[model samples]
Target: MSALLRKIMNFGPAFFAIGYTIGTGSVTSMIVAGSTYGMQLLWVLFLSCLFSGALIYAYGNFAIVTGQTALYSFKKHLRFGKPIALMIIVGVTFGQWNSLIGILGISSNIIFEMISLYVPSAAEHKYEIVLAIAVVIIGTMYSILLIGKYSLFEKILVMFVSCMGISFVLSLLVVHPMPAEVAAGFIPKIPEIAGGKMMVAAFVGTTMAAATFLSRPLFIQGKGWTMKNRAQQRKDAIVAAVLVFVISGSVMAVAHGALYHEGKRITHVLDMVNALEPIAGKAALTVFFFGTLAAGLSSVFPCMLIAPLLIEDYRSGQLDTNSKQFRIITGFAALLALAIPIFGFNPVKGQILTQVFNVFVLPLVIVGILFIINNRKLMKDYAAGKTLNIILGFALLFAIAISVNGVIALAGQF
Candidate 1:
């Protein structure tokens, strides 16, 4: 392979991370924040992504140095590692499965809504149409994973991620948001307004999710990366973080420009799409929907893969990504999620719960990572230095604060 091809191939894990991070939940959360607060929470997105990158690096380093995925590392190293690993598995699986259901619902809704734009009658039987769309999507995802090896799968995800990123940026440009307002959004300030704190916590949970950290080790292992490729791993983390910022930031910009101060509510993906029509024109709306669809699909691919892959990690066994067992496990998750669209649940609440669960369970992973990474016996000379610990410490504190606030918010709601 040429140097360029080789360089691109090395970044597969990062692309997977990007595909997973910038999915429907990120888009929805960004829209929620931007439409409600008019970019006042851009600082939250910025800080969350920044901190997430650091945490990703920290997690990736753990995998590289030890040559073990995160769950396996946790199980082998800490005194309570086994129970902690099981807890993480339960937490991540529950949270992601919930979000995955919502993601499928959102994607089907967007595709069907677009179809309904031309064929109005289709909207009349929305439920059946959504199920049909869901079947096609879920089936397609299963076939891809069943047929392709890791490299090919990574390439497909990278392509969609690129498409989503470009489409969002182009749509943001069409809206022509004010530079001063965009600049002002970067100055950190607490959201004192109603829904402000919840938005901050949501952004943090979505952007800096525990699943992102837990899943990285699997990707790193899949890429055949080791300590010898440490620099490359760090580069990939930076790329993933940058992609998260650009794609999610663009979504927020468009939301702020088109929906903010418009006396409109963005209750769903379709609502946001329709809201943008009067402001950014039909062309922009089309581009935004395509971006949203791509984002949703890209994320769905990994969300389905997480549980089965984690099972492999825990067992310390390699399951063929294309095996029937693997596909069955993945497809079962998709099947369960079909209930969300059929039996209705509030997507916004589902999204918030997804992020909160991730944030609430994050400290477990963080502590396990810190313990193993700092273990001189396990990490050898690769034990984490003081500087890395300080960074991880800050991340832990942020997770704790967000978790506390999220619990409080949810309690108040009750």
Candidate 2:
């Protein structure tokens, strides 16, 4: 392949990774971060991006060296045996289920709003049709992935991410957040917001997926990456990390400039769009809706694929990315995409719950990855360096702290 073509091909996995991160929780989390903290939490975004990028490089490199996914590596290196592996497997399954719920919830709201616009009179009875449309869209996504051609899906996602970028950029230009506030956000200070507790929880929760998704290990196994693939993997991680930071930052800027300044808080993705109409016009509302839909659907595609792959790897004792069983699992997960719309839960709430689960799952995986990556036997000459070890150690502590705080907050809500 030509040098230019290789660079383009390399973009595929990174795009897929970012698409996965920009899900329902991401939309709400970024908006909440902006509305509640304004630019104060901008530093969190930058740090999380760096943390996620480092993890991707570490985990992706591990997968290449050990010839296993993160999950498989955990089982092998930890020697927790079948019982422990089974428990982790169950946790992952539930995580995937929650992800499906969050995705469908966001997509359903967008469709609901779209319908209300065209047939305002029928708005009262649109839930049934909205459910149907959600099913059709999700089913089509499943069919495309079942064909096992990720290239097409990646292309579509890149286009969607591009559209989302454009929408946010346009909003940013209109809102024009003060340079001082923007700079403050990048400095990392907690603000005295109404939902300070929840905002903190949400910030950690939102970035939880960033670290965990990059740690999947499946990407490395599927791509047949090795130690020799380190440079490519690093490049891929950089692309994914940069895209995540820019897109997320843009969303924060839009929300801070447009909604926060008005003292109008938004709890839902639709609310964010609705808030934009007065400032940026109805067309801006449309653009916001499209961005939310694109982010939700694009993330759903990867979740569907990952769910089955995780299961198949456990049952076969190997990571076979192309197995028929894996494909079937992806199809089954697609069916779940329909159920969330049919149930019609609040996307904002669902996103919070999903993110909480993601944060809950992070500690175990981080511990496992840290142990495995540092194992001299497994990594040979590629073991974690001093700087990498220090970073991973801090991440582990941060994950635990966030998990504990998240559980307490969740329990208090109950």
Candidate 3:
């Protein structure tokens, strides 16, 4: 590739952000929200992505200006920040591990479904097919991270995002949802279902994920973005936020139009895939699965990276994909996730666990960023201004509210 082409191909930090946020967590949350409540909660979806974007900017801008990763800043500034940062690492790592099962499970299921479209016999060996697909997907991710540089990972994720974006948008076109209903979905109204409150919290938590913010600084630093790249970082952040909104909204639109109107239910993630058979035909079913597969793989790659990156941040270590410690940590996460297929873990329970941990972690992370940005000594002239503080304040409140709701939901389960 030429220099110009390579520069364009490199994309930016936002691409990684998009790749991380638009994964299985976003997909599963959107699917549940759309299927169960129709578009009554679309307003929340919009807000989640918007708030997430703002937080990404706040976090990304901090890293760019200070030349420090988030965890390091936390450790340096606040007295108790080290423990909090460690907590974030453990919470995010464990949460993503639980999420890995569902992500990999859903991804493998879609691949199985796509193949089963032609090979009817493939239907009988569902477990084996899922295992094969999971192995291949995780194996490829391990190889990439092991042999490739951050640039290679970014390039591959860009392709994954593109594939998911195109497939989802095209599938939405086939669904041909009503414009007025979609518009009205923007009007805020809470659902009164069984898990309505938790679902709403899940929607918000999943979109504005804790791991995404925690991972931002490392990704930006990897790209060599410093204070000089602030303008480009802002531009990249905006574009990434928009892509997050579009991809997530497209999936919800397809689900609401196809599943909700038909009074269908989503008992399993794969159920959504099979449900697509009649609404948009086999071609769309294939398209949706491929899109889902792309989303899954995109997410799995970053989900695996979090543990190692967290360790890097905690130790203030250099990036070393070939390091023994890094490989062991990453490998542990990958292996743990693979157990989902081996034991046939419950996807719903895994999702609930992931969301609960996410809600619990969200507020702490927002506060960490808030503290970093508000620290005059640390941020100096780059400290968050009034307008930005107001945005973060709302986000902080939102996260707290969601966390509370999640707690109540968990308590009720007991």
Itemize residue pairs with steric clashes in candidate 3. none
Model 3: per-residue lDDT, tens digit, 74-121? 887877988998988888887777778778877777777688888889
For residue 104, model 2's alpha carbon misses the true position, in angstroms, by: 1.5
Candidate order by lDDT, decreasing, is 1, 3, 2
Error of 2 at 45 (Å): 2.4
* TM-scores vs. true structure, each candidate: 0.94, 0.90, 0.95
What is candidate 3's local distance difference test score? 0.80
TM-score of 3: 0.95
Q: Is candidate 2 or candidate 3 better by lDDT?
A: 3
What does candidate 1's lDDT look like per residue over 1-414, in tens digits? Answer: 478766777789888888767778888888887788887888878878887888899889888887778888778778988898888888888878877887888888889878887788997898889888888898788778777487777888877887898899999889746888889999988678776667777788778877888888888877788778999999989988888998899999888888787856577656875788778777778889899889989888888888888777777835358667787888788797676677756565577556666677878877888888888987898888998898888888888888888887777666
Quick one: RMSD of model 1?
A: 2.1
- Local distance difference test, each candidate: 0.81, 0.71, 0.80
List candidate 1 stretches off by more than 4 Å: 1-7, 317-325, 346-349
Per residue, candidate 2 scores C-alpha lDDT tens digits across 234-288 of: 7998888888888888888888888887888777655765677788877776776
Question: 63, model 2: CA deviation in Å?
Answer: 1.8
Candidates 1 and 2 compared by TM-score, better number? 1
- Candidate order by TM-score, highest to lowest? 3, 1, 2
**Deviation from native of the Cα of residue 6 in model 1, angstroms:** 5.5
Angstrom error at residue 344, model 1:
4.0
